[model samples]
Target: MVFQARCEYGMRMTSAPDPFHIQEELKYLRLHITNFLSYQSAVLDLADLVALVGPNATGKSNAVAAIKLLREIPIHGLPIAIARRGGFDQLRHRSSGRPYNPALRLDFQFGDNPVSFYELKLRGMEGKRYEVKQERGVLHFKGDKYAFTNNAGTLGFTEMEGGHRSRVSGDRKIPVPAGQSAVSFPATFGLFIVARVLQLMQTVEINPALVGELQEPSSTREFEPDGSNTASVFEELTSETRAELVDELSAIVPGIQRIELRRLADKVTLAFVQELSEGKRREFLAKQMSDGTLRAFSILLSMLQESRPALLVIEEPEIAIHLGALRTLVDIMRQQSETTQVLITTHSADIIDTIDIDALRVVWSEDGASRIAPVAEHTREPVRQGLITPGQLLRSDSLDPASA
Candidate 1:
């Protein structure tokens, strides 16, 4: 029912460890983007909070799409992933009267001063072979590390001296064809603990079409991208957490008092209803919730899983959420951000108005580049006056025209 823009994102590190328990680390998403037809350059420093607001077709979704593009490469085969989303030609933008550079690079910071950087130059594929024009990855530890690439043979370190570096490389760089991503190679064996946090927290995607099967609550099932398992997730919650979630959800769906996640007849299912109602709140197969309710449930539930993700990427968090519930949605999201880096993209002025003035970024597509810049200056007065809402400021001239 909601025709929303599509989005994509990524997260990964060298070791495989959940972020909640790691105490001595910091995670961030920084990009030095260029080569699009516009000659426009942007270094989007995604930190504690970042927001991009712009009009339709302004590339707000495109940037998010790139991130998801990167993530899907690892989860599903890249070809299938791309096709499922929109296909290759759709991936590139028509710019500068011609396509500019299609290169991409990312630098990830971890620990004290250690950093890991990956860069890839994407080009057209010839038949089944998409020759690599240039590719490189580096690990900086103790101020010294190794570098590897398809072009520049190993200069210093090829494999991590202490860990299994070769296996990581084979999966990340070896088999990926051109016009694709290496880190997203699911077949790739390495899952760095740090990288996974950022990646897992990367943008979230939901397919509304999948809602049909999610009508009922699913206690034993994992959360579906579409959020069909929301009722079940709450059903499985401890009494305390369930109370909290119910309190929160009640703010949105008037009757939704409690959701039960239970396994009966050897099957996991979700059960729920208006806190004030008597009969079945509603029986959904997990696919039956209103698009809006399901989307909200997805956001709330996903937060519980992170415990603490270095970065949390949310695509169109505003979709399906009622304008009235926008404030509560932002409040909970901010609460989650206290422990995880949060980045969201939305067109709703209401959603934008609630964001702290200092924590805003506006993304756009002009000329050819997908660019993002701080909207801090734009948000100052409104924040001080406490007049316009965060969401309003985000959508007003206070933000980019696309945002306005």
Candidate 2:
């Protein structure tokens, strides 16, 4: 909860907007991964809305997995995050029968502030053990730059003083667990930006599997990543938000008259109302709704939350949904991206066509290594000239990345 306290202090001292407020903008600009998963090296020049289109096994999901891991670092520490994904050896990129260490770098910008960055490198030790090779963060506030670093187990801090960057206040030995990151330090030594970075990252949420399953309502109002708590979250929404949600859902699914939160004694669930002939209506419980309907509802609910995350990653959102509904989903996602950085991985041609050309990054493999880049000029030309649509190009397996 260090970041939580620091977040409140930061807003009070600077009189800045709350970081979680939907109107505030704090977003990731780029993500660079080296020797992680199947990607020997890959870079995603993130935009407000980005679509990763590629053939299966081409490493689209790997890119998402990398970001998800970073999001969990501050929450679970470095060791457990790695363990949750198997282990360091399994995550490291392998070549020629040897595993290589993996490194991750993320660039972020908040409002008009200077671009800040956090970089992490994990080293593999003998006997399959792993340690934090390096963890660093730099944040610029007002006119001063604050830098924090942990080279191996040595924790250090530096700041801009009198116009020149120097190790001010000398170095102090800080005890940081070998398996933890320096960014998760309990006392940030007034380097609020360091805590801010962790706070921002902790807000990241990824789409969960089986998004449509019925849930036992709880008091927690926030949308859970797996969407199991969706009914409770929906019940907490303001009447205006509920109306807006229904309007959008009706556009996407049609015949969706409204959605109601039904509570029976100690149990709570959702009731999807559909209009029928002569102003008649039919009601379907959460368990009775189709998978596609439930999935769409869950996704829409996540995007409509009053407190949006810094980053949202969704994989293959088009699955089990009709083409028409997919279009509406894409539109809503695009609008939501204005408030949060939205990254999606999909093989759906309809998806490629709905997104802007500049928002598309094509993932492909070369010599068994994953590579990603904007659509190649040559490959994107036909779509640009209106001779071929992105959907058509995707279907033909011709969505190639531009040459470096």
Strongest candidate by TM-score: 2
Worst lDDT run of 10 residues, candidate 2, spans 1-10
What TM value does model 2 have?
0.88
- Model 1: runs farther than 4 Å from truth? 1-26, 35-41, 77-85, 125-129, 140-146, 152-198, 207-222, 228-243, 262-269, 277-290, 306-310, 376-382, 385-404
Estimate, for each residue in 10-49, the C-alpha lDDT of model 1 and write its tens digit.
Answer: 3322224453343335556576555522324566677667
Overall lDDT per candidate, in order of appearance:
0.55, 0.74
lDDT of 2 by residue, 232-258 (tens): 878778899999999988888888988
Backbone atom clashes (below 3 Å) for every candidate = 55, 0
What's the distance in Å from true for residue 83, model 2? 1.6
